[model samples]
Target chain A: MTPQAQVVEVRAGRTRRRGRLVAAAMAAPAVLVVCAVYAYPALSTLAYSVSKIDLSPRFRIEGFVWLRNFINQLTDAHFWQATWITVYFGVMLCLLTVVLSFLIALLLNKTFFGRGLLRVTVLLPWAVPPVASGVLWVQMFHAEFGFLNGLIRAFGGEGGIIWLGGSTIALHSVLVTEVWRWIPFATLFILAGLQIVPKSVREAAAIDGAGPWRGFRHVTFPLMLPVVVPVVIFLFVWAMKVFDTIFVLTRGGPTRGTTTLNFLTYRQGFVQFDFGNAAATAYLLSALTVVAIAGLGWMLSRSRRLAGM
Target chain B: MVGTSLARRLKRVLMYAAAVLVLIVTAFPLYGIILTSIQTEPDIRSRDVAFVPTYIETEHYQRIFDEASGIPVAESMVNSLVVALATAFLTVAIAVPAAYALHRMSVPGRRVILGGFAAIYVLPTLLFVLPLFIAVVQLGLYDTYIGLVLPYTAFTLPFMVWIMGSFVRAIPVEVEEMARIDGAGLRQLMFRIIIPLLRPGIFAGLLLGFILAWVEFLTPLLFTSDLSILTVTLGLFRSTMDIAIGQLAAATVITALPVILITAIFQRNISEVVTAGVER
Candidate 1:
């Protein structure tokens, strides 16, 4: 209306803009810190993966040898062996974690006496600290003084199998420990999904003459995929990055059997003091992780957008 | 869904038995720890596994309160509490305003910050260890409370930003405009009006941040080694590395006691905190 009123309106708009600008200003410091923290090691590792590194004080820089580190990593027989073992370890945990937990979730969802108490108990391992879980599992899997061996003997099997002490048995020990720690997490997420699934939906499907298996396959299974798939994919990523449990129980094994990518990164950087090679390996791991996570997340977000969930 | 009510009842009976098995599998470790702690060393090693001890003793637990070290467990317990509480305060202090800016404000980089959620969450902690180690060493903050506290906050701040951002967005911007209309300045509105409304969000962020910081290990394990800075888990791990097997199990039970006690005591609040997370 009036010139003074117009000027006041514009000024008020700028001030409000400043208030909202606080979020960006605050976010700026955190982003810089995260990027700097994340990028330096990532770039350093990528650089090292290509070429050799000197442990000397001179610490000379070199050009990209172009996949030489990966070649070395892959070509060495031990490296290839470790890779296969790592792959197997990752797969067993990932599959068992997803499948068994899904079944347990379905079972837990049914009406039962003391169900609430059981749900909390399922989370006990999850609540237990990781290192403690590792210790417990190791002790249980121990050959002489361990529970599993004792139980096997009690049941008339050969006792004193070296679960963590034997090369072949060590990976199995690591797997058991990993599964123990993560099953609870998977169960929790699935249980959350089951809670969200309306009773009427499941009951109505049953009312429509679906068998128990078919009812789950059609009614509950589809309802669960949205929650379950993401949990599995995310946990798969975590399983790849696993460190403490394996390091604790096997310490890269009876003969480097349990050494994982992360464990190798630590060994290279800290133990070997080969910063360059460690940096390179770290970057490769980071690149692989970011690609997998970003790709899947983008796909999920797009689908969620379409479904408007 | 069953053809007959009798058949449906039978299915429930079978399910109940299976559920009992699952319950035992999960809870037995906890039972084992408490059982092992009080029993003599021979008792644990003798039986295939002792389900029940003939006697319960306080020697294992009381050792925490005994000795001249003034309960090493207590010190580490305090260390964990200090880090966790400070992490909660520091993360919220930084993240709340950042969230408000990102959620309420439409700046040039708003979309970039919002999209950062997935990137931040999925980035494994291992990748950052190298630089973070270097940064802490350079800052001369290594092995200090601040060293552990800062990184713990950074690790958890992403969740804070996301959860608080969603919570802030839900509350209408009308409240801020009302405060502004009353001649409240930017600082006034944020501190006086907006923050009170963000109580639930802040509480949620604090609980999540506290639990994460309290339980976190690798970062602290790598970065800090000072006895003063050792966490409950760290102490448990370091002690267990070379000691009596029963004592190790005892320590495991001891370390877990706080989390279990807290969760058992505040089950409702814990769920509420996670609920805020899932909503985001």
Candidate 2:
């Protein structure tokens, strides 16, 4: 190698190193947009929880009120009521959606006539935006002209039942709408898990003493559980953060009967302009979601290995 | 052996029946909307619910175009489309390069980066809403298109990067090294060679990203106030406040059309994309 070629090569290598440094520098800014716009706000939320942030022209920030908002949130009847409602709603929604979706998946997994068309239709409600689904349900629940009222009256019943009016039925109404919208997602995930379950396992099970129920119980259901556990965690966290369906359908209403934690956060932040309490409420919700999902992920991974073995 | 085989066939027949029943229940509401959208007022109002369409009325759809999505509908739909499209474009743009970097270079802490991204992925939907809302208002971009789209890209990016990142890593590292030896720069290798090879992954990622933006209920609803961002979801929202069944059902079908058609076209692949999304 000549000295000139060596110098040129050395310069090229140095520039390449410099180029990586430049890209690395740019990396923070590029991704800082993500962190700033997304994660930073959540961090800011934590700060707001401990500090008092009043929304005036200046939106004053007073320091450190450790767990005061949480105490107040816990003390507030509305907050506790919202928690029970949320937990109840989440449990019911997850269980029903999982069972329904699995049954639906079982039916659709085989080769049959018009399977393709049924698959398309199944994706329809899931595909629509949740806000849209909420709105459609509200319309369907309408009297004198709603499709649902029409169905009820057609079945030889007096059809003037108002589903969303009272506080008792109001929350249940929202639950129904959520189940309607979310069941398809549950079905789709289980269906995905079903795809890889070996056909021969079932055949072998059937070749011996097992019946259909026993075959699935021993061979397929256990294999499907690893995937289903993660999905349940997802749906649980998702249901906790559900705001659109509630906002569109009930607006925490008749008397704040159906308010979840997320709905309360929105109410405090924007509707009532209580930024400090709102941010605090959000952090509470976020903390719960994080712990639940992390815990579920850990458990699922452990079970995956055990199941695989 | 023959009797046992007959029993197996019978069980399979029962399975098909169960699937059909589930489909009928699921399809009825949707069928109601499409039928309601096309029915005359009296036909819809008649005591009998007709499964068949007697007459086709294009009035509400025509009104959507003719009257210019009057009074907030047009603005909401346009806002939604703008937000969704921008989200799809930006997410793909940023994810491809970053994913390429992670895929190609010996980046330190790759597993940590991957895990951090996964942890962030499952953060609940509106947990960031309050702080972000304040930030948007603070930045003086509240109610602006960019305000919504920028955050949206943030939400979907991690999921995209992780899914597409793992997929890009799945491609053999040798191909890129060969391209590098043959006088291809990083840009050329990414655009000319790697991206084409990643078309399936990119296509699937883009689909999920677009759907995330389109079907997103909470974020857009929170941010936009003054200028009506015309959206089908917003149209359904009106149904909550008022009956206007004809108009709402029409809007419902309109909102649901793109999603239904797209899912139908890619039914085989969507489950994989969404299921893979769960890993992150």
Candidate 3:
């Protein structure tokens, strides 16, 4: 080639490279922030998990114990209990949230009078901060002065329920508050899922003489699975990590009945200042969450594949 | 034909009934909170509580603002606003360029960075909160707006980047190419061509970041002990015992109202952004 052409091509290459450099420069602030925030914490958590944190004047890593904290946490009965509770809570929360929100989404998806108003109303609960929801529910679940008890009494039943008092009962109450708080967001997701379901598909199902239930089961629900699967996994992960509502409503109380692994991590690390144990629990919870999500995703996709969807 | 019409009517009735039920279940607690906030303390504590207020009173709201009540409602609200606004602004500013780079430019390790961010997004704050807390202390950022603002920005950054990246990707690359051909530098292309096209996503990210930072309880609870720096959510927890039920309800309403108002006003955009990736 001519020397001028070669020089022009070389300049273009340099410009391209310079453009890339500038783009990278633009991304540097965000990349640095995330690394400092997430990457650093992640590494520090790993380090703290293996070492003993001595709280003398301030938080100082004394030395490495290498898996003793993990061993201690794994062997602790409370850890096992928290594990069981976390699993139960996450599973139950996923089930209730998906089912209820799906039903609500179905209702909201239909063309009806005041549909827009109802949508706004349903969406409002999600906007209420979890702490506020916790406080709201705490009042509602109050045995004497609560709206729930008042309703029960108004309906001719003997009133005092001690909703947040008993171990199992308190967990259930927390579950209710969580479900209440979660339904709106979940409904939003499902409604979005429902939106993508085409009219012609439903018409085809109807023309094929499929009843409403069959149409929903075979056509619409299947169509929603793509969205539903991820939503379920999201809800499950969120449930396992629920700290604020539980912290507000029960404080993992009524005899540690509601102490999920997340709360346990908080209790161990912050309340007891057992930073090592807390880090271990957090890591374990992360591992369990990852496994559960992976397993659930596998199961969902496998089932879909087997079903030939 | 009559029977078919009857069946259709029944279906409509059932649908409306179900819709109302959904509304009631979703909205009743909110209504009850508002009701409780307005009711007299004696009425609230009464075992035979009326769903409708027996005596409507603004005393609870008054007490929240009242200095003797010791709630610091106004100050905490201001703190939350400042932190949330700062977080929202910072998150969008950082996310937009990062998103453009990821979506538009061939940055090295782009896939890995995006993947890491997606991973971080799915993982709970529990995974990072412990060490983050320690780091904040060591950096001498504890109990300060910068401390809360920085973490909140970080927490919201990955999600904002992803959302804004989706927006950036939606804009035709041909537009940027044309600008480049016109001798537009990368900055000019981004500022003039890209950011204008990314307006919807920017608004979504800003509003979402604000809401996330506003509602955040754990970060403030863990990081700040100074009364002046206390966020509204943390303030709700602080006076949980000493505060009367009516006053607490007032605080709850005060804390919850802004988000509710935002949702009401921007329901379409907020929901669109929130459910962005969910649709097939």
- Selected candidate, larger lDDT, 1 vs 2: 2
Query: Which prediction has more favorable TM-score, 2 or 3?
Result: 3
- Model 3, stretches more than 4 Å misplaced? A299-309
**Candidates in descending TM-score order:** 3, 2, 1
lDDT of each: 0.73, 0.75, 0.89
lDDT of 3 by residue, B58-112 (tens): 9999989887767689999999999999999999999999999987888888999
lDDT of 2 by residue, B151-204 (tens): 888888887887787678768978988998999976788789989998988898
Q: What is the lDDT of residue A250 in candidate 2?
A: 86
lDDT of 3: 0.89
Against the true two-chain complex, what DockQ does each candidate achieve? 0.47, 0.47, 0.78
Which regions of candidate 1 deviate over 4 angstroms? A1-9, A44-67, A153-158, A294-309, B1-3, B64-71, B170-185, B226-228, B272-280
Mark the regions of model 2 whose C-alpha exceeds 4 Å error after superposition.
A1-30, A62-64, A158-160, B1-13, B41-52, B68-72, B181-183, B228-232, B235-243, B275-280
Better of 1 and 3 by TM-score: 3
- Interface RMSD of structure candidate 3 (Å): 1.2
- Ranking 1 against 3 by DockQ, winner: 3
TM-score of chain B of 1: 0.87
**Per-model TM-score on C-alpha atoms:** 0.88, 0.89, 0.97
User: Taking the tens digit of each residue's C-alpha lDDT, what string does model 1 give over A118-202?
Assistant: 7777777777777777777766776776777777788888876888877777877788778878887787677777787788998
